[model samples]
Target: MIRHLGLCLLLLAAFWVTPTAKAATVCTATSTPMIFPQAGPTQVDSNAVVTVTCNTFGLSLLATARVRMCLNLDGGSVAPAQIVPRRMQNSFGDPLNFQLYSNPAHTVIWGGSAAPGVPAAVQIDLEYGVPVLGGAGTATTTIYGRVPAQSGLAAGTFTNSFAAANAVLTYRYSEALLATPPWPTSCLAGGNGGASTGFPFTASAPVASRCTISTATDLDFGNVPGAIATNRDQTSAVTFTCTGRTAWNVGLDNGIHAAGTTRRMRLGTSANYVRYELYRDAGHSQRWGTTAGTDTASGTGSGGAQTVTVQGRVPAGQMVPAGTYADTVTVTITY
Candidate 1:
């Protein structure tokens, strides 16, 4: 009886030491479908949302896993290509040995193919570890890109798919949100916001004043008969009337010439035939007068009318010419 009891105890010990078969669970994940916009300018704005869930299946804390995202051009009908793969991040913003790849300029087309000239689609793969403690895990990530016309993509439709997997974990897939980009415009008066004023606002050309020689008289020229003379003097009165009531400055041009002739003669010369000897009294003696023997004269005039008399003289001639000799004088006015 003692031997039999020992045998039963040995059998119980063996049964207690035996290990039981454990169930296997694979890590899995699901992603929402992604869509793209059709006809648009080179630069189009768009956004997409993806939801990923992971299950550790009550694994040990030391157990690690990986997640990947891929883009399938030409619709889900074709195989997905890997793009940027990022490691999952912890509660902190630090990366968990992960990376992400994306092309902001991405567009889709029909015919179960990516836009004819469109670049290869982008893909992202993420890898992470399941916490030792059993709990539900979830992450929602946003993906954005722009569509350009150069990619041979016209106004059309597109689709995207996502998948996740682990060695011993299960995953569920969810639909992603695809939205059309917003368009912005300018709302000013003109296309250039009233920047360019079409018409020019400029004044007309100034009207030149019309001047005429009114009166001229010889001063202090005592009668002469022979060649060579001295101390001769004369005076002349010149009157000017402005059609428009505008102030003007009357000055000598020093370009005195014979009538209808281009040749210029110097002031106080025989060819000039007129010399400004000295300025006598005038209404405004202080302002209207010649500078010593200088031929030029300067003075202001009233708007309606004004007159100035210039005092001058000629040298005695040894023999006075018989014929009438004429000299030209020029008067210029500026307002």
Candidate 2:
């Protein structure tokens, strides 16, 4: 009985001594890939810089990891897509094409030593230390690119993806942002400065003068003889005063007269003495002289003020007519 108890105890001790293996499972965490600035259409001006950011989170890996970016043109999944340099000159003065590489790559290089066809894609490898409990970790990187010339290809929508493969990793991509070229220097200069000189203006005095008739004296006929009587000649003067300066070219016309008729009757015979004449006195060059009658006497003054005279004469006749006749004159001036 003691021996049986001993064997049972020994069997129980052996069972306790033998270690039970516990199954171990590989640890892994997945995160969604993300791109910054969203993903859509993109445009870049000449000498512009474009930035692309990729972020990875919730990765459970304690070892090194890598992130890569690739571009597909016209749905072409090839390693590299063709990029045609537009409005830009290449190293050899030829058009440039697109290229790709494994190293962190970027697109759109500006006036840089690197040729236009350089790779535009990039890959970033992150070697994170052992992951802490709860599978919490994150990785981020940025890629820069540039535009080459004043103008480039018509911008369009480009689809890109950020993928974290080794071990389940979650990643996300943000919208794409476009960069514009610098402002034009010539446009700024035109606003503040110009080509011509703007200064020193002058004005001159007036050139011509004007005048109007202020007053006109009434006509006075001297005494007249009765029929079968004697007749006498008489003279009278109508004076005008000038108010303004000298007129350039002065002229005169018969402005005033008996209503409806342009004719005037004289004291002598109807045909001989019907018209009148005007003259200037030698002593007073500005003063005018009298003539046969008062209807036709007219004159002009150019420089200064002057006097005007009118004269009339009646001839003797067998039967002297008895009546009164009169007319007026007008004057005009021009520059």
Candidate 3:
């Protein structure tokens, strides 16, 4: 009976010396950079793929390890009091505002690289003998990113680098039999059974110089009464919007009815013509023409709506029957 008791003691000692599955658990993480296409006045979105892998070693069949993990992203190169709305910077030290999200809808801000904001969470299950992941479980998640609509000052590359703890993976884990009913509910739920890791990443995008020409009113010279007698002048405005610092030139094409570079107004599809001209200045000194380098109006963009005055004139001295006359000229911009 003494020998039997001693054997039981030995078995108990062996049981106490055996290491738990959680002891061998070591987690790691990696990610792809979030990159965006050309940015504009409207919001632009992007995605990054993050993967977390937790390993469980030296466990028998049917043994399982469960993990509660929190994934957090801090403010990038541009540090803000809050991590929800982060900012990136250009080489010139200019700022571009952007944000990271946990959900596809982008309603849930991705933060908690430090605290306060909710950290992204995941539940991982590692079956020791499962060949699928070779005794390890992995969780893959997508990080949604956005750059809100903004008026840009210049066209250049904006970037943010996430490293040295900016991107973090904090986790808590426990080992149990396959039939165990419960596990940690969150990364912080398992008390002291937690650790953290880091993975570096970056966010970058370029804003190309963009320009749009808005339509304008036609040059209406009103009604020309009787025969051509004096010069008739009218003005119209053409508006264009572009990114700051962009150089553009505005040009005017000869109307549909033109006689060898001379703009003319037509009389109801007949052979009759009325001589009319377009100019770039109010004084009508600079004749506006389609030649971009010579006769086009040039200016630098201010990232706001800008106007170009289209001055029209009828150098009245032509003999024609009194009838309705019209002409349509195309407006073009060269950058």
Candidate 4:
């Protein structure tokens, strides 16, 4: 019995003296980029996911670990400025403003402690050495992105890159036995194995060439009840809205019934016709014609309502029956 007791004591002593591997919670993370839908003159929105993976690496007698992560995503270059956040350079740099948020409503902006903005927080529980080989766990959080409504932005792909050292990933962890209460309160707390590293991600969207003619006022010369009328001058307006910095030409097509470049307002289906013309200028020197470059009003869009005046004139010395004379002229906008 005494020999057996000595052997047991030796075995227990050897086990206690043996060297042990360090216990730690090693963590890594990846981010999915936020991609907005096609953005135009209106605000666009999108969302992405950040996946955090925590692994109980090495030999740890710890049964479990609780991790706290803080994501500071604002300030510096990764900001949501209305004009500088997203830029698509064509001939010149077109600036479009955007922002990042933590909530789906987009009311809460996503920023880090450095931003002094509310940083995204993620907490997870991981089991250490429970699976025999090792144990790992993953947690996911969402990031919302929004590009506020703006105009005059050049057409191209607009992107905001959070790459290189622009973005940072950080975490804090504490190990314990099963059903443990004490854990790290904040990841931003100083010291105690807190680690920080950078991760890369992007927020991108595209703007295409687009234009619209919102309204067109009629050119009314008023009633002319006489044998022949004096020279009548009238004007109307055409409103065009297009993407900023876009070049466009507004052309006027001849009426439904016309001879050569002459535009005339026919009286019903009779042989009577009133000679009239549409000009790009008030002096009636530049005739508004179907020609795209020539005889057309050319201008660059400011991404807002642009008014084009159409000067119309009816020459004197025309005899017509007492009735309403009208002509429909088509307005064509070429960009």
Candidate 5:
């Protein structure tokens, strides 16, 4: 028993005296999420930063590591092949077109090997000498995003992840103590190798429709003679400018004199009225009323000034009151 005890003690001392291999290196990655702003132009941009950190325990000699990163995107309504023309979906499942790039210049498409035509992965080459125990070094890369011009999309928040969906980021690194390594350009957007985790980011765009209406030019008729010989006609215009392809309607409400849809001009203080009508056509066949898509002037915007001609006429031989004749019509545009 004593001999066995002495042998065990000697083995324990030898194990303590023996040197083991230096601790292996480890790496971690994180990203700053990006948000793209709303715009009418075909292209818009936003940016985010991806950071990689590597740590090495105290070692007498220089230690180096090779790191790589890639994306594992959640499937979207648009196919992976459509990554060049990517689309983000809203809560209602509506899609807004957009894309991600590797540089601020937006020349290169950021993608993964998993996605054809897209880059397979990104690499970070690191090197450091150690006397300090477990020191960390960091490398950062920028990601650019763009939202292309669209016919139309409702205002809301759009994202890559919804429901149980996720946009995963995979990080792979070699064991510490490797020689200086070469950087790879081919594998940037696609996941290459290493451990992975959820990379949470929010992509959003706010849409606000804009339009301007002008009634600066009102229908004005010169002083009427005592006896009307023929119909007195006058022309005025209502001009508007709105965003491209935005559907809008112009409604001219019944004048101050209210007789249902029949338009009229009234005396300043008296109940007496003169019958008049507003028409959209020169022939006065299409009466311009207040009903949308029915009696109203409806059009799809071209992002420019659009004029709607207002033709008015006073029938001859009415023999009505002759102070100052005028009518105030309310023009309302619903977009």
Candidate 6:
């Protein structure tokens, strides 16, 4: 019985001597969200960094460490995956396609790098021994981001939140009993000193200037008296629309039968012509021509459709032309 008790004691002593494995320690981390300026037709790329730091108390105990950072992007909702073509949501629920890359080259994927339980996190692996020294172990990793051509989206600020479900930075680590490798020169004697929260960012773009002009309108004065009789007048209008505050000009070119401001319309299929003139005001003055601001109508756009009228008159008695008279004038708009 004494021998049996001695064997039991030996077993208990062995149990007490054996070292127990402990759970991996998590480090403190802080990150700044990536910001993208106004996007254009070409790809707009940017970068931001997240610093992961470990307290000195447990830094020396960790032999070799492995870390993975993940990005959960919802674009204001839940994302299907973490690959290219990731969308961002606007206040109006509109979506814009964008991408998050693991490296500067954007070759590897950072998909699902969060804690073991979270499935939607996109992750990237950093260099081992990120926190080399025990006192203040800290390391920084770059997040490469890009917003492809999204000219179709309206001009405004677009964003993704990281606090709740959209875009958050998550991390996990594993350690062993062996010694960690030497720290890189960049991270040597450095550590993340501040607190970190979820990473969020903004993507934006400026809408290009746009303008449009309508088709021409015909100005006709039918059946005018021949030998310097009474004056015949007609009116036609052209409509145009443009962005607000845009400066624009409407210039009317010399008609096919014009001779240096002396306007005339030719008889159909005949060399004979009838003299006429186009004016801007009612008094048959202010001749409309190709010169901007002087002969052409100028105005500031109010972001709506506007109409400008063409005044035409056949002055009393232009001799010639016994048949149908016509003229073709080209309208030009410069904005």
The residue pairs in collision within model 6 are: 30-196, 110-122, 110-123, 111-122, 111-123, 112-121, 112-122, 113-122, 113-123, 228-317
lDDT of 1 by residue, 1-335 (tens): 45544444444444444232121223233333333333222334445544545443444433333333233222121122322221221122222111112334332221111445543433333334444453344555444533333321211123222222110111211111121112112111111111111111111111223334454444334444455366454566667654232345555433345333232323344543323233444432332322323333444333234676665444344344433334445555544
Q: Per-residue alpha-carbon lDDT of model 6 for 120-225, expressed as tens digits?
A: 4444455444233443356777767888864445333556544433455555444444544332222112222212235554434333334467755788676655
What TM-score number comes out for model 2? 0.25
Our model 2 lands, by Cα RMSD against the true structure, at 31.7
Q: Cα deviation of 39 in candidate 4 (Å)?
A: 1.6
Off by over 4 Å in 2: 1-199, 227-231, 241-263, 266-305, 328-335
Instruction: List the candidate 6 regions with Cα displacement exceeding 4 Å.
Output: 1-58, 61-210, 225-228
Query: Each prediction's TM-score against the native?
Result: 0.24, 0.25, 0.74, 0.80, 0.57, 0.53
Model 4, global lDDT = 0.71
Q: Give residue 314's lDDT in candidate 6 (0 to 100).
A: 84
- Per-candidate Cα lDDT values, in order, are 0.33, 0.28, 0.77, 0.71, 0.64, 0.60
Best by lDDT: 3
Quote the lDDT for 300 in model 5: 70
Total clashing pairs for each candidate: 46, 33, 0, 4, 12, 10
RMSD of each: 28.3, 31.7, 6.4, 5.4, 8.4, 10.4
Best by TM-score: 4
List runs of model 4 lying over 4 Å from the truth. Answer: 1-21, 41-43, 60-62, 76-93, 114-133, 149-154, 176-181, 190-192, 225-230
Candidate 1 residues lying further than 4 Å off, grouped into runs, are 1-39, 58-73, 76-101, 105-133, 136-143, 150-335
Better of 3 and 5 by lDDT: 3
Tens digits of per-residue lDDT for model 3, 165-212: 788887877765343424566676662266889878999878777778
Whichever of 4 and 6 has more TM-score, that candidate is: 4
